[model samples]
Target: MKLPSPLYTTQYGKAYVGDSLELLDCLSDNSVNLVITSPPFALQRQKEYGNKSQEDYVDWLAVFAKKIKRVIKNDGSFVLDLGGAYEKGRPTRSLYNYKILIKFCEDLGFFLAEEFFWFNPSKLPSPIEWVNKRKIRAKDAVNTIWWFSKSEYPKADIKKVLTPYSERMKQLLKNSEKFYTPKKRPSGHDISKEFGNGNGNGGAIPPNLLQISNSESNSKYLRFCKIANIQGHPARFPRQLPEFFIKFLTDPGDVVLDIFAGSNTTGEAAEGHGRKWLAFEKEKDYLAASSFRFLENNKSDSEIQGFYGALLSEKEVEIRSKQSALIFK
Candidate 1:
């Protein structure tokens, strides 16, 4: 089906509603600048979100990866948030989600750039037969975010997103610099000048562990549930998760795509960060959910209280005109 043209463009830009795979097919190679998505997990356990057998799950995910590899620009990056699955009754992990996806992306000629651990402190402890039934707690967290690139070395602006060091670390580095002498130079080395003071952007680079929680019960997820007429997808990720990647990976006006647009959190985050977004959802309920969320968040003035008087009753058909009038006034 023909897709809708991009809606009104601003800092945080437009969202398209459709099937992601089909919409991706319509896009040209090297068209998108960044991609951030949390695909439904392939788990044996029943989930409110979609679930399938291992074979079906990998295959379903791989198909989208193939298209993503094609459309992503050479310098662009794709961040995938995947959670592991457990086998039935074993009380043990069976499948490694990242390992499977890494293999799939490698087969498609995408390079593994980096891996991030999203540490959700609020995660419920997983019940364990060995631990809970007999002794203690087993593994708790399940989610991981993988960074993939189309080339061996994709462009990344590391300095743009650097986090500052803690006070304790700063003191340690200061004390260590006095005794930390430079290694012996080669025979012909020109070791002339002393190094400058170590008080630059002090402390080590930020570790890959990202501490974020699921959206608050009243905000993102609740808003989505109200507009979409469906419960939030069980595996729906928080907006902050995608917001981090989009802001760090792409500049303003860059196009970001989410193939499995459950609740369209990626699109919402992209828009908030001033990037254009394209999202695909096959399920009608999902599409409605995404649209309702997008419109509610990006509502024009005509849809609000000021445009509801009797004088404007019959003139609301021209949405753009009413919006323009509201903007000018």
Candidate 2:
């Protein structure tokens, strides 16, 4: 069967170096199975790559959300990873993400499937003014992951993203009689004996707070970047971020798209899970450096070269100068 061509297609994914909005316009309606991205945060101070200011952040993201709603299939999902930011010069936080969420639901006709919080335990303390000096607020470590669907009933299976039962939970299940007794609580909820059934086949449902460690001290990707003398994307998410959503939202061969693919973490996760994926990044250097993430998967030297050539190729790269949108801290 003949497949539609992308800018630079790989064995398991494609890379497009341009504005995500333009790329979205080129894609067919209802073609993508999932849209997962972590756009740069609207922080008080800009980082290495540029980000939208608080004044324009919501409207800018809303524009893409409107287009994404069209490209996603009826049962498709759009997973967004956004870090919390403080208002410019103020100790208070910014509600730009909430503003975008409201716009998505009210204007874009999207449903709020669920809100997931990603807690990075290894994250360092930041915003010295509040956390270290005045001591008014704690160090911010949790990022918001909004799972929006085209329709209210998007394709999802909790079983795909279930975590293994804890050792304590396992002991409790075996000794329910000794540990947990069925009883009505102060909340007037009935405690049933059926709580322990079918747990062997299924692990417990993960909570909204997903505590995935993002501590990668040294890895192949970093090693490759070092040898190649390339500056990697400063704000890269852990692969586990996308892995959870991709597994929960899509199946094998499903198409996933990452509009703001800093370091292409979403594409890497999708490819690892046997999903067809696409990535769009405006920063040429960052997109070129992100190719290092797949070095281990290349069986031969030729294969590695072929993949790198495709990403850095002049003919393959449709370069466009756009303000980079990325922030993970």
TM-score to native of every candidate shown: 0.75, 0.87
- Which model scores highest in lDDT? 2
lDDT of 2 by residue, 29-98 (tens): 9999999999988876778887888899989899899999998999999999889988766789989889
Error of 1 at 17 (Å): 3.3
lDDT of 1 by residue, 1-329 (tens): 45555322223544444567778878888988888888777776666666667657777777888888899999999888887666666656656575565576667777888889898877765645544675554655747788999887776766556678777546545654564555558875532223345454543456688888764677644564554344655567778788878877888888888877777788778877768887766564454444334433454434433322311232211123224432212
lDDT of 1 at 24: 83
The number of clashing residue pairs in model 1 is: 3
User: What is the lDDT for 199 in model 1?
Assistant: 59
Backbone clashes in model 1, listed as residue pairs: 11-274, 20-280, 131-136
RMSD of 1: 6.2
lDDT of 2 at 56: 90
